[model samples]
Target: MSFRKTGAAILALVMAASLPVAAFAEEEKTIEPTEVTFWHGMSNTQEQVLTELTDRFNEENEYGITVKLVNQGNYGDLSTKLTASAVADELPDLAQAYNNWLTAYTDKIVPLDEFVENDFDDYEDLVEGYRAECEQLGFIGALPFNKSTYVYFYNKTMFDELGLEAPKTWEDMLAVGEKFMEEKEMPAFGVDDLAGFLEASLAQNECEYASDEGALFDNEAGLETLEYIMGLYNNGYARLIGEDDYFSSVISTQRIGGYIGSSTGVSYITADDFELGVAPLPTNKKAAANQAGTNIVMFAQDENQQAATWEYMKYLTSTEATTEWAMKTGYLPVRVSAFESDEYQSFMADDITATAAYSQVDAFFPAAMFEASNAVRTSVNTMFEEVVLDELEPEDALAEFVQIINEECDVE
Candidate 1:
């Protein structure tokens, strides 16, 4: 027990103590599964389906993570909330957004590449054109969800009684409308807004609202599209109807002969005491086109939380999940695997209306935007509204609209 021996014994004891503490620290470092929050714009029937999926995930998943689903109201309201959340550093793990708004939120989002290497793998499972569109959005920007393409919706009972065939070319569509307006005292199409028809017209012509550089909807293709819309006004095939009139007569009880509307409207349209039928959008030539719907995007979150969010997102957009959603809501399944699967085909086979919608899947366009383009579409719509209501000359209105869009859209 001399001084040197005592010092050595004390040093050994200290090292032993440190070894046990370090071991305890290592043992306590197990990674805990993180909870994820999903904010969506779905309401009513759509809301119910989303909730059911989340509940199933919570009940069935092996991971000890909980998913909280929140209804953030409609798209506009949801976008507002999302922006506020980002400002406060309280953004949710996942958010549902349309492409237009998703563009604005790009900086705040977590690139999906962090989890999946090649997004094309996911794309390959979806329709080819749509897959290309998603791939163009850059590394795993969003998961396509809640998709829809526009179609011509007609009342089967009415169409049969009138003996009218579904329109193929734009001329056929107008001819059908002329008969409906003059003889049956019914309009061919009705909607709260005119922009839908304008886009449909552009689709009919194999033209887009914007080019790759982002020109608005007032180019040559745009003007031709507008002219057709003007024809609908002059020919009396349609009327200027708001949401109230649309749901009441043109839609609900099926008083109207035919109308252009979203394919996703299938479930709601069928539920209102009418037998509904769907046809491809009327085209200038014989082909067809319409815009696809929204996608799911993840905002910036911590690493563990980001991983959990993607796990739930994959479930939401998986072939199985999208198939269920397609069946329940009458939405087109975005996944090619889902569309080609027997389960999906069988679901459509049992329902002719859904089947018709399914057949038109080959004609959808990816949603995109143009530079300073707001004025173009809005101007075209305004021209239609004025002409239909007899507020402006069709030629003058369109000419002015084209001029305005061209001026604003010019490259510097």
Candidate 2:
């Protein structure tokens, strides 16, 4: 053959080699689905919706991957189970983990960058904003699954009856909360606990719960932030509740006017027959919110199971799956595509509270760093609670808060 002809022949042979591999992938897809176990920390009504999604994925995927869904209990319970499993070398193939836990569990989890590269072209299309935060802590470690942001869950009917607008600022919140209590005979807002709420709001107000460098916690923002919670408690606007209970009970029963909770709290609202309104957590002049909810993390597994697990993980956060999960369970969809889908748009249209929650996602900052950074926050909560029950002076409690955080949350 002539030199040109020989070169063309070589190119054709290379193309033929690639085509066979592509054809094999298509043909091999007909084989039995791989089995994957997904251990999660959702319960009650949320568990039902979660199972439905896993069933849907099983029903829809051509790639033979069967997902065995397991509820490992709530956050604390799940974390303990995961830790024990890790030590025993028996962690689930895939798991749902809090963003904070990512740091502690990074060793056992696979970084998802390779999976994103192979499975999806635009990883950013899968999730945004907080992707940087996720990556910062080791991006490859997990996929954001049931993510949420703090939103003010309010009683819309009461607001209308009283001609009250959604409170925008802390000052406005205080004024409205006081008026609601005095005139409407309601506590203004109910909180399950103040630590998480106060940390998020203070972060929004440019308060550093821990330093930006992740080195220290006792800053002006941190102290002022605690004082703000003290202000709320002192004024009787926010009734502190326990972590084990749902504040929706307080809202539905009309025991409280509203509550500041996660966008994910909608699942709890389903059990109660009440009109709930959702709004972004009341902001400072500069609006900010800390992201909440869990991520789908992978544990150490064999290569075959890892590949299969990635497939299921990809499905969970896909436009269809995330939309289904968000609509049914009230967790905000992590993917931007999920928000634009007709399913998400229609759901938001039907519910004003959903619309409000959706609108605030842009202002959210993922609370991933706080799991390790905010040990002092718990101390602050205890001090704030004392102030709430009139057991301590606000300034005195705050001074103690500064001391505690300095010792605990400080990186030194």
Best model per TM-score:
2
Give a tens-digit lDDT track for model 1, residues 1-412: 6998989999999999999888996654322466788888888878888888888987877666688888888888998898788778788888887645655456787877645562224645766555545555576677778877767778766677778888777788788888888778877776544665665567767676554444455567666766677677677777777445453345666666777766766565643565667777776743555656677888746766776676787788789998999888777787888987899888878876566666666766664455444455576567666667774455665665555556556632
Q: Give the winner by lDDT.
A: 2
How high is the CA lDDT of each candidate model?
0.69, 0.73
Tens digits of per-residue lDDT for model 2 on 54-129?
A: 8987888777778998888788898888888877888999888865654555677787777677666467775565
Off by over 4 Å in 2: 1-33, 127-129, 211-227, 242-244, 270-275, 368-371, 391-394, 410-412
* Number of clashing residue pairs, candidate 2: 7
What TM-score, over all chains together, does every model reach?
0.83, 0.84
